[model samples]
Target: MTTTATDLRAQAERHLRALVGRDDATLYDDQWAAIAALVEDKRRALVVQRTGWGKSAVYFVATALLREQGAGPTVILSPLLALMRNQIEAAERAGIHAVTINSTNSEQWAEVHAHIRAGEVDVLLVSPERLNNPGFRDEVLPRLTESAGLLVIDEAHCISDWGHDFRPDYRRIRQMLAELPGGIPVLATTATANARVTGDVAEQLAVHGGEGGSEARKLAPQPTVARPAPQPQEDVLVLRGPLDRESLSLAVLELSRPEERLAWLADHLGELAGSGIIYTLTVAASQDIAGYLRERGHEVAAYSGQTETTERLALEQDLLAGRLKALVATSALGMGFDATLGFVVNVGAPASPVAYYQQVGRAGRGLPDGARASVILLPAREDRDIWAYFASLAFPAEQHVRTALKVLSDSDRPMSTATLETYVDLSRNRLEMMLKVLDVDGAVRRVQGGWTATGQDWVYEQERYDRVAAARRDEQAAMLEYIATSECRMRFLREALDDPEAQDCGRCDNCGGFTVAASVSDAAVQRAGDRLTRPGVALAPRKLWPTALANLGLDLKGKIAGAEEGRVVARLTDLGLGQALRDLFRPGTPDQEVPVPLVQGVVAALADWRPRPDGLVAFESRTHPLLVDSLAHGLSRHLGVPVLGRVAIRDDSVAPGQGATNSAQRVAAVSRRAVLQTEPVAGRRILLVDDLVASGWSMTLAAHWLRAEGAEAVLPLALASET
Candidate 1:
């Protein structure tokens, strides 16, 4: 049975119908074009279509067709574990053998590898991060790249810095494509790239010969990887479809308060047609909202990056089977969960309109004609604060990056991130991001023990960084505009992405197609307010000092004993009273006496606190001495407890910010200065008071010293935590 190109295309169409479980299924012309380019012509292509446009079908069908031609396995660089899992399940319906190598399925890697080597795998999915792993990069990648039938980048926009959700790990893809042998089909796909990101990605694809020979735009500083000369730009076949999702009805609800928004969700979640997602800006909000909804009798659960991998799989299944009403989630649950979601509600606006479109695109994916899913936005005032917090963690200053590189180059051996933090002022997240960027740029490498310098020439590229920062600010402003605009919401989103065919969707609130009430019951608002305003969050005791501190010449290592459990009056991100605490502790704000309301709140918190304290002790703060002293004296006076002497610091000792950003360095810095002033009180119960707690190391070290002085218990009380 010799199959011609037309026969193969017809067979692929049949497979698509069988995969979707509808005999009447038909492939869109663009989908057919993309599949043929990959399987028949063996040319490179980029497919930019909206979500649920059968982008997966193009790849799955192409993989099957290519396999029939006796080609090697199809390699897919999927971004998230959830996306990989969904793709693998979808592949199964088409009777294709798909296996994944990821952090979650490490135990089965040997089996997967065996399957690949045995020609038993039709498709192999790996995270882009896997490309940098020493073992995989040196061993598995060479084999896969050399023999791969096709290379598919699921969310291709991540390869470009101009993309809203750019990742450094994706930069490795350019190098991977350059090394790939010619005559191999390559495909890149995304649903959320704007014109700028699209051009950036297209340039890279052209440079890699995905396009026959388009001039490659130098997007970033050149990497050290060896690259071939640019081919002709005619090689790339781009299939861009309309960005609008016709099955969605979009609207915006302006709620003045967090409590009121929560009340509205609790009241209207049941009214939404079918199961959907409720998106939040943070993990704390997701958990809080999920808990509140459950108490109000909605079958909901929280999903975030922090959720255990196994539990996340189960939660996704629950949502898919319609066993749960909604999964309150953060951006971690954003990409590629192929469920026929009926609605989506945003509790807070994302800083980028492109990001918002990608998230809300999850709804109505599988809806039939005449059926529409609801997409609503409930914008909050606190969103800007959250945005600022995240923006502050962006790329480090040039000096910090240089310092890290110099330290790594001079080190005799690999240095762990904790050890590296001892030399850099950047936080753990920022430092790690810098290192990854350097790793891709050929300035550093990650070995078995830790990170090491590669001694390659590096440039700061200030211009590129500035451009990215400016782009981010513009995106934030656009998000604000999206919330305020009286025009079509969907149209605003599409236009933000610079979609060429964008027009009035005629289905958004501003278009008068649908309306969602902004009202909440007074009783529900009162209850939600009570929940939000409720004070006191338990602070878990520090179990162990950070590992490898001894390696940095600090004696502090191993478990931190005698550090009693702690509590805070409230988190800085809490819904109720959070804004007041934020303003009170804001940077550059003058040191002042504790507010009366906070004093009263602390009094309320202590009433519920277990085991009344015998005495109150204060810690001297280099940052806010007056605040600490006032708070200690007020709590002592209100509780009728004795005032113990202060734990003073030596003038010669370093401040908290002067030391490493790691726990061990902070503890070492604090330990050199913290000294008890009063005589030891044997067998006494002590309450340690501080104005604010950032890392909790100082409090832990203080408790260690107090326990050494014969204190029975140490209870840490702070006004607020920077959660």
Candidate 2:
């Protein structure tokens, strides 16, 4: 029954052949080393290699060998469900039974669990988020970890807060690892980690047995005592390989304008070797670019977190099967599979060099006819601004954390996120991420009802957080430097990733002296310009009052009785005129008559507006009140409508400033201020105007007051929406 090293190799070779469905398939040197370390030595391994490196092969083959030696199933933690789908198929090809439990497959979890208990499932893939799922963590995880023969952490860079894909959920893996039965082999793999991230991940992975993760890190808040010297860390076998790939030809097309970038995609997207990806920084940008490309006769689709799971899967398949020329996507379409991905075009530079490398790694994975992928970055001036926007969402201040902790600690019962928002000042996503970190820190616990405090001592690691923020800023600067660099593009990225074997690939545009057509067609530019300039976004009414408003002492709940959809001239995030409009609303802009161009846009909007307003009522602005006055009066003359009057807000000194503050707080702040000083709106459809709409509450409450005052209909309209 003893399995020798030679015997393990023979079995692995057979599994590899079956997995790849190639008769002569053999393991790469790194793959074999990783496999041997896990299957033979029973050591944790970290495999840092480029995409298409067959990292999966190492785990699958090792699974087969380990199972033959009477080990239990391997549990693979994958980032994306799309990746899980591919992994399952690949495991099936190797005759290994694999099942996934994720958000999309909740209906099948029962069946999967039964299969696992029956020993029919040889491998199980799960999302990292599942580690913190109250039910899964309390019930399923303990049993799974007790019997797990091997643990595979895919996209392992996500474990490092310093990595481009740093996921708060992935941090819980350390807790899972701590409780995992000793001698269960663990394998963590990623294609996009630099030395800093690599060391960070390795250190986390080396948390010896039951005392896991950082001894005590950021994410938690309260107070902590100084710990004694840490014990020696466990040894993790590190398998790192050169990042460069022969199949990828890196390039940069420096088109400074959004129009030129869209033009470039439209002009040459079809000529790209096969279906691929077009990355944008925002969901709106993805949708916008996809629509523009389709108009230009290229078949593409937008993929983002906003895309439904079913639609995302369909779009992913279309790109993989060549039904789509590309999927214009946000980072949400993370690491989807495509055997013939011939290119990866970045509409704007990624926020970091590692992010750029990770995104570009999606291309040239495996191309038919040996066609090299065109990895290009079309960076715009707005890219830095976009990067800063994302950067601003990093860790909140200690005071913000303390505020949320106070709210939770005082609550006797678990509070849902929406309810918590009534007291906390953080946005939904940020609050949830903070809670997850706190959950790991034992400061709070998410249960069946919602989330409750544990009163466990937690320390906010200020020094560590400061370092992380500094690192993030450095990455952004490096991203800027990446686009500005005239040297070898691939070398720049590889070096940025701290790939020890970094060298000029000799295929990048800079090294090969290959210049792609940088000039955009005038007609294309004009069309793109038109598309960017013609802006109007539907402003959705805030239908439901935020839950637990009682906590805020407002007593508002349920759906608002009367709400109607409205329109804005543009979103604050939109390109073209939106940029100009945004500048006008910034902290120090002059309060004068709104520009003629914007006035013309508003006039055009008014011309198309239905249920024509009998009169205009401008909402008082907290900033740039003159602009609103000018816009309202100018529209009044243009529409030949009477000015009803102005609406004023009862000032609340405690109102939080508009930033990343939550909806509940916005509602709380605005609810105090709806004082109608306007003319009677009885029997008339009133036009509710504002300088800009953010959070929609200002409009919501204002419109409600008008409707309550007997307006037939309150039609909310704004110059821009901060969507």
Candidate 3:
């Protein structure tokens, strides 16, 4: 009288057939195993497989099966909007009504909620950030937690701090998993988790729901309740398999400079198999490469975090339709951008092989029979510097966390992020991330207004962070080794993800297969070099003082009247001249006369000015006094202008490198220290010169000093800028 395993498999295959819009469709053996674990045992499972391995079909089929068994709707915590779009369509094809409530769709929420209450929705999708939304967390999520048929965490590697693309919001999934009712079917899925990340996520998945879990409610902002302790729970069923795609061919093209990399891409993009993505490590690189490629007659666009959502959608559609050769993108184009992409070219190597695997998986997913896809890497020497810059944004130091917790614990009312920013010196994004992590750690909570400490005895977990950082360094070393490895290229990447069945792919460049020509024509190199060498960066002056300067013992606020338009030879993050500037400004580089090429770059910038400066003033750099002074005097002589003297450091207590911190601290350090000592500060348009203008506060406050001393106007110039 009982339904057999064969019966369940038949039912699952029917669901799959409906999902894929064909009667002959069937789940892979691994996919069927994942679905059976969820539907039969009501167990928690973690599925780590390669991309295009039918991870989504497992869930959609299980959703249809569970819905038909009289369970409530399945709940999926997807990481990207693009993934939600893909899944909703797939669910409908299986005759399972699906709905989503995310940032992009507010107008449909009431209707969607009505459908859910009416039992018309079979699956519901939301981003991890929505899990912590004050309204959604308090109102909508609690209901879904208690009654959901199945819980799915897509892109599950993000939940681990050790993962390359760790997001604070994904950590909320741990707490959510702890709050889910026991015996409910749960699934966590990712395509790029290594052994360490896989173990971390699996450990979190075994935690059972607590009876009296803490709430993220807005209180009177006094003391708050501690987060609930997790109880002992069941084991997680882990299904991991070989991470190899037969359709992909991997190769590394080592070039010495950015221009060579750009030239290689330009000379060979058309020769690539089909439309795909070109990944970069920074937004500046994405924009610069996109611009150069467009000039070379490639129909391409740059995509990054700064890109508008609507425009990203349009670009994705264009790339899908093959109207564009590729998108020059930062990591923003990653994680759930499903297309039948034919190639993925790395402009610069990613930080880890795990991340590189995820990016390259985007290619060859939808290729036709027996046709292989290309995945190329063009690594540069600047990669480690860029990596270090991102590493600095990791969890704040112990003291910073103690300060923030103290402020939150003492406050009478919930402080908004802006108000908290006046006290914490961390940047806004980093501060918010720290708070989210703390909230998950039970040290803090994000309430209606902003954040509040939970009064728990929170410890910094220094050893764990150190291990994570060390793992990151290992991954970086591995990535470098990947470029130099004489072994099979695909096998190297597969083993990087800890694939047990990794084997020689036998078709990579090292395996005697053909790769694109590493050599570029001199004409192409010359054109790329010309684009990189031409450099003039507009520097917008600061217009207002940062808020709550009094807290830092300064009285400045409101409109900053003395600041004006400025120029720089180029940004230090620029594609072409950036390396030259970065080298000259390296930490131990000697202070000396400016290089002739840099001097020429400054001259080219000045030639386009409307009103040339009559005088030049240098910021007496504690680190590079000779360089700053020489550049200022050299420009003065070239323009036949007067030398007005230097802005001396009045308060040596304010370190020269303080300007690299957050805005409030940067302004605080310089506001009281910059003293214009020149005798000829009156009735002259002074050209302010410095070694760099990283945060603009140094120039703003120095110009404030000059304007305070009755200078008519100020125009700033720097050898390099970072903003």
Candidate 4:
């Protein structure tokens, strides 16, 4: 039976009133109206909206209207089992007959299949992982195909390789549609998707638009009759920015010590009343921190990969019901989570800016006032250095795709952790992660023995993976560059992602001027003559050494002893005494100021040091300071003004006139002057700096920092090549 626009509208209103209330019918926005029109026309559609923008409501209303008018069963494919359960419960609450097929159903699968075929079930919800079930494909879907079926693929971005979360099973969706009796109309919806993913969905669905004329002409004639008109691409609607939540105050804290960080968290929990989530990187970290917080009299629950699905569901339910004050979780907590009353706190730097944004999005779901998001930086120098380094690296899409493919293909047979690592170059841990994604996407099948590539079309799937991987890599690289930039973090993010209304968030670390001052400078220096004798210390060893002496740099000496004859041990120890050896073997902390250990007569000898035939040199303590000062002056002149300052000074007594060519000079030249300050400017040009170009880590970090500091443009500059 054909339906008119007016008829569909009246029917939709009645359905909406039945499900929610007469008041809720008026809540349908203009976007929902547009979506309803598409459903009335019986056309496939893709709805792209931000999180909490009511995409689900629109679909729910559309499904109800279609069912009331005797439209065929509406099948919803979700990514998570929890999501499936939620949809079923919501449908049941609305008086709609809904049934779900998930991991828990063994005895009920046959009953559910029979019910769908007999048209007894109006709405069917299932996880994407279950689509490959032969029972559904061969028995139930065939009967449903006799009537026009409505298929809704929620979280549609999972189908795109470029999306943050990609699923291999998403690719199987097209095949599933083709196998059905009458081609079912599909509605693909997602919270995020750029141009590339949008195009991919259209191509996969074989949907044609204005330029392509009609979808029929674009497709080759097949034995099966086409069912309905393909949906046109809808324009992406971007909402206004600065989703400022008036009730919550966002802040960032830079803690000086680990213990202090815990204390700060405890104090904040004591002060804040609302529920909250603390996000950490690892499961162990989340558990450890949650335990500490609980010990401090704060009620807290931990959520990680190790948490059982049942337990996690219970904990989430408890949090939403206001039974739990706070929860500590890893990245897993954000997806499909709906808690309208709370804040999100990041324990350390997120792996990427996208991740940070998604986690923060958890708050302010439906509240009139927005929610708060905070990031806390720890005190350790190593933490700072590591974060800074991570901020610098570029994420190239092609490289990641190639790496993922190589890993996937290396395994002759689909194997899990232990066996897969022997064939793939990736670490066992990383391989397992990719496998999980593949398993979700239905690209691989899991059995008692191991995993197998169940995807029928390997070539096309591989190409899809490549394209999406490349896009992801490009996005990551661009994002990294944006963050390292010396501009307003908001401006860089907005410009890069094409978000027009981005303002100075005023909540970032740079915007808040939360950086602490360095405690020391010129911490330590090694002599130039000492470096020549200990060249091995300066270079990484080619062979592995015993773990005991690994950090002390003694293993290389042992290797040299093995290479030599009876005098090996004695000769190796003698090398340490040489001027070159002493210079290169010296190790010191990254602190700015290093105290020098005084030696009798060495200062006088170094004052008149000269070069020897072996490329060694000597210098006095006072002369060493004078030499460093002169070099700083020369650098200042070269750089136009006085950017250079005293970093370190080295003394040597092996030769009086060896000059700057010695090992000590080389080391000084290689060292970089770390930036002390960075401020965010609304519209200022900035230059990004990195220590080395390896993987462009330093460059990415510098650019991100620059953006955070409010620079308009950040040009990346690197000092050395990582390769």
Candidate 5:
């Protein structure tokens, strides 16, 4: 009853044909050819392709070929919940026994464990986070070892920080694999990875064999020791002509103000006549803008990290079904979302060029002509400042490496903030901003417990830190050079990432001759200076003060005796400011008297006040002086704003980017009306604010309740950077 090699091969081919609906003789492309060669050679291989380039097909074909040769079930370590679900669904449709194990299902986990042990599954898909579970490694993976398994790590780039989708759990997969007794052949596949990332994957897998080793060994050489083969001229495929996506057109509009940006987006969506995506930077912002759009009669959907998975799936299905015409989402929507969106709009500049590219890429999926994409630049000076800061940090440097290490080592526990002043020599504010960049690269963890170190697997030996630091410095310098060059932005991005043969993408700003002007008028510059000098201007501090001192329940004298009340007022004005001063004043109440009055004034000025249309009222008194201190410090240097007194107001009625918009005066009429309408609830108004807002959902929701309860005006404000 045993199957022979020929029988197995024939059966596997038939199964694959039925699954893929393609014939082998249909002429494979170069990517497929390369994959087939690796499978034929029977070696471990790492394949890196571009997004949407059929990487899964290569791996699936390889899987079939290997299984025919007597390899056991395939184990795919994926990092995304959506991706795992999609793979499981695909497997089921193809008649393959595939199961995904994660934290979602508590009751069925035991059954899944039993299935793995009994070898009833052909594919076991799991997340890197799930892989860390002790039960999975001790009970499940060990049992699979009896059958030689094909271990495939999808989104393998998560192992390296240079990759866009970095995950700390992915970094540990190498050790996880090593713990298993059998030398199961590992295949790591990703759509994007630079030279460093590719190398890191090989080293972590311990697949380093010299160039002369087995094909797998050659393909999966140690990243540190491996020298990339000279890129073949013919191997470079260039789709360099003007992308005449007749279905898509490119446009850029200058928005005069923040409100105007929202208006423009709403109008654009109305005119789009098809499904669209509006990419923003925060969940609150997405919700706010989506609400506004929905109010304006657009079928809008909002997607963010806080969104429930079931809701997200429902939204996606709606988008596909043409029931939802527009979606307002954070960057979280781009990875592996298979919607046929007709347009993509970025409300502001993306954090990185790669991020910008990825967001825009989401629009053109499966389009006959291709989808349109645009970026609407607002009139906010802060947007330009943010872009400049991003540009400066875009290039890696030795200082960044040092800062990263200090952040990692100085943390009392695993913390993600690399910019903590006590831990690094760099300015704390600068470090704080740079942390976002690192987070995007999967270099740090962002969790509610606090920022924790996530990507430890990519960290080389401390002894080699200097060497790696130096190499990174060079790489960053190259990136900087590319950014400054007048060549096509696409070309520059490719060159910066060591892409072998990047050609001009005629659709980009550079190729399309849409350069942002590099000159500032004296009048405009002087106006900026005058705005900076305005009273009540908010400022960001240069560095972050110690959290311990801020948390202490004492007066100002407790922390620093003889500190001027005015100095403290100007220094601390955000949510935690008064609390920090109060902590300093705890033991000595006498010293607290001076600080208490001064701190009270600062807190009151910064305190959030809102009035609803129905005689309802809301007040917030949680001012953190450090928040404003840091912002003021940063703004003073950049905007030359001589901020005398700063306050962190927690009002929901004030729209974001409206710091200078006289929110108190503007909301006065609505507040009085609301208070008069609902005298009973006027004394119990609810106010709300957050660290950042892109669309303004939190503000709107607060406003809704304030109006409902007969509260006074519901004011909203937020501290946020442009996209």
Candidate 6:
């Protein structure tokens, strides 16, 4: 029953044929070399290759060879569910049994675990977050480490802080590596790592079997693995190849306005080569773009992190089956797929060239020779502001980190994130990321109760954080430069990624003598303008008071009954009137009467509002009394409704300051200042007017008091809503 080299090669070829459904399927030199290192030499390897460079083939072929030699299952640390599903499908085609453990598959974990224990699974896939799970880490990881034939880290750039999409959970892979038995043969693969990230990842991979030596010392929050002094450089093979994509034709289309950009997409989308992706910067943008495209009679769906898991699965299937033209998506649709994507259109500039390369790399992958795919970047002026907003959420200041740790240290019991927010000034997303980093660095522990401090002496690396911040700033500058550059676009990107073989791509817009049309039809532009300018975002009434307000000494606990629903003429972040509203509400600017255009829009909205108001009441604004009074009087004059008095602030000490504090704090601030000043509304429908609605607490409190005073109904209206 012994298997010879010839037999192994034959079996690999068979699997390759099955995977592609072609007899000519074969592996390139680097792919075969990676497979040999894993299956024959049993050494750890890092393959930093471009998309469609057969990185997956290396691991799959190696897995098939190892399984024939009676090695245990291969465990891959995949980043996204989309990736896991794609891997599973590919594995099945190769006749390999594969299963996944992720948030979406919780119902089947018990069965999957049973199958793994029973030795019926050949490959198992898991997300990085799963490594820190209380149950999986304590129960299953130990067994998997001992039995896994080969460990794979897909999208391995995520392990490096320098990576565009760094994940703290991916760092836990080092601990897993330390526990893995010698000669297990690990493989880490990525398509977007530059020289710096490549080096960082290579050192982490070498942490196994004492091979890291001093190179491992180069990493931060150093691996938790206790190693006997640095040994010789391990057989860590780093196979970095050229990242040039011959089948990709790159172009940048600069539009003057957001609406114009949408119009151009409406005009050019159908003309693109095949089914592809339309990448947007935010969830709102994705939804907005999808709605517009659908109205234009194109079949598209919005795919984002906000998308439900089942819906995401369905969308993925539809995209793969070509039932839909494209998915207007945020970065939530992580750049991972095996589809023969023919085009990719980025609606806004990504913050960095590295990220841009990764996104556009999704297209033209695995295309037939001489077949090209289009990659377009529709640059917008708003992209820089969006980039700055995202950059603001990077790792917190040392003082902030220390504040969180000190609070955890002083707590008697485990505290949930919601409770911790009452103490920390950071946003929920930033705090959770910090906690995860701290947990992995041995500064804290997450248990069933909640999170508890571990009291580990964690040193805040100020220099490292500063360097990362500087790199990010440089990347942003580079992106802006890319937009203005006349040099070859692909060459600039490849050089930015430190691709040694970088060269001018003759197929790009610059070298190829082509330019994306800057003109959009007048009709298309008008339709886009109409959609953008159309206002009135529904302001859902607050159903329940924020939880645990009692701990903050507030009497409020349950849902606020009889909460009046409301609407704003526009969001301060809206596409059309946002800038105008933002300018009007800018701090330190003198208050003026309501602008004519905004008044017109508001009047238009009120004309269509359900149940016309019988009276108007102004909410006193300590900062903008003139603006508030003017708006109320204008509404009264325009609609011929009687002007009832204002909701007077009880005292000077109660105005909620301009900055966004938490919901509970805002509500608490409002309760003391918002006093019902006028006579009881008494069975008459009333309109509550305000200059701006930040947290909606002021309106909520006002409505509650008016309803209590026997008002028939309260309809809240605002000039602008700050999200």
> What are the per-residue Cα lDDT tens digits for candidate 1 across 275-369?
99999998878988898899899999999999999999999999999999999999888888889899999999999999999999989987878
TM-score of each: 0.95, 0.95, 0.93, 0.56, 0.56, 0.91
- Could you give the candidate ranking by lDDT, starting with the highest? 1, 3, 6, 2, 5, 4
> Candidate 2 on 1-723: residue-level lDDT in tens?
777878778888998999888899888888888999898888988889988878988899999988988999999999997788888888998889999999888999999999999999899999988987899988998899889999999998887767787888887887666656789989999989887677767776786554532333233422211122222245988888998877888887787667777877888887787788999888878888899888999999998888998887788778778889899988887663635688888887888888888888888876665568888888877776677778778877788888888888888888888888877778888889888888867788889988988777767788777777788889989988887788988889889988888888788888974457676789988888777777567777878877878877886778785447788887766766767777777767778788888877786666665647899898776667788888888878877899898777666453425422688888777776557788888888778888877777777777777888888887888898766
RMSD score of candidate 3 (Å):
3.7
In the predicted model 3, the residue pairs found to clash are none
* Tens digit of per-residue lDDT, candidate 3, span 98-134: 8998888888889999999999999999888887677
Candidate 2: segments with Cα more than 4 A from true spot: 210-234, 336-338, 368-370, 652-660
**Residue-level lDDT tens digits of model 4 in 494-567:** 44333445566565545653232222111111221222122211111112222223222222212211100000
Candidate 6, residues 1-723, lDDT tens digits: the string is 876766767777777777667899887778877887899889989998888788888888789889988999999999988888988999898889999999888999999999999999999999999987878877888789789999999999898888888887887787676557887999999999888787777777777636542233233336332222223245688888998988888999888887898899898889887889999887767887899889999999999999999999999899888898999998877657778888999998999999999888889876788999999999876677678778888878898789889989999999887777666666667778888888777787788767898787888877777777888899999999988898998889888888999988898898874456777999999998777767676777887876667766777768786447787888776656665786788677888888887887787667666648889889888788787888899889888888887888886775456213456656666776677788658898888888888778788878888888888888899989876
Worst 10 residues of 3 by lDDT: 218-227
Stretches of model 4 off by over 4 angstroms after superposition? 1-7, 17-30, 104-108, 132-148, 177-183, 207-251, 256-258, 368-497, 500-723
In model 5, which regions exceed 4 Å deviation? Answer: 1-27, 34-39, 68-70, 144-148, 177-183, 206-256, 271-274, 369-489, 508-723
Off by over 4 Å in 1: 1-5, 209-233, 652-656
Task: Please give the TM-score that candidate 6 achieves against the real structure.
Answer: 0.91
| Regions of candidate 3 where Cα sits further than 4 Å from its true position | 1-4, 104-115, 210-234, 609-611, 678-684, 704-713
Query: On a 0 to 100 scale, what is the lDDT of residue 414 in model 3?
Result: 82
- Give each model's whole-structure lDDT: 0.84, 0.80, 0.84, 0.48, 0.48, 0.82
Supply candidate 3's per-residue lDDT for 263.
Answer: 91
RMSD of 2: 2.9
Question: Higher-TM-score candidate among 3 and 6?
Answer: 3
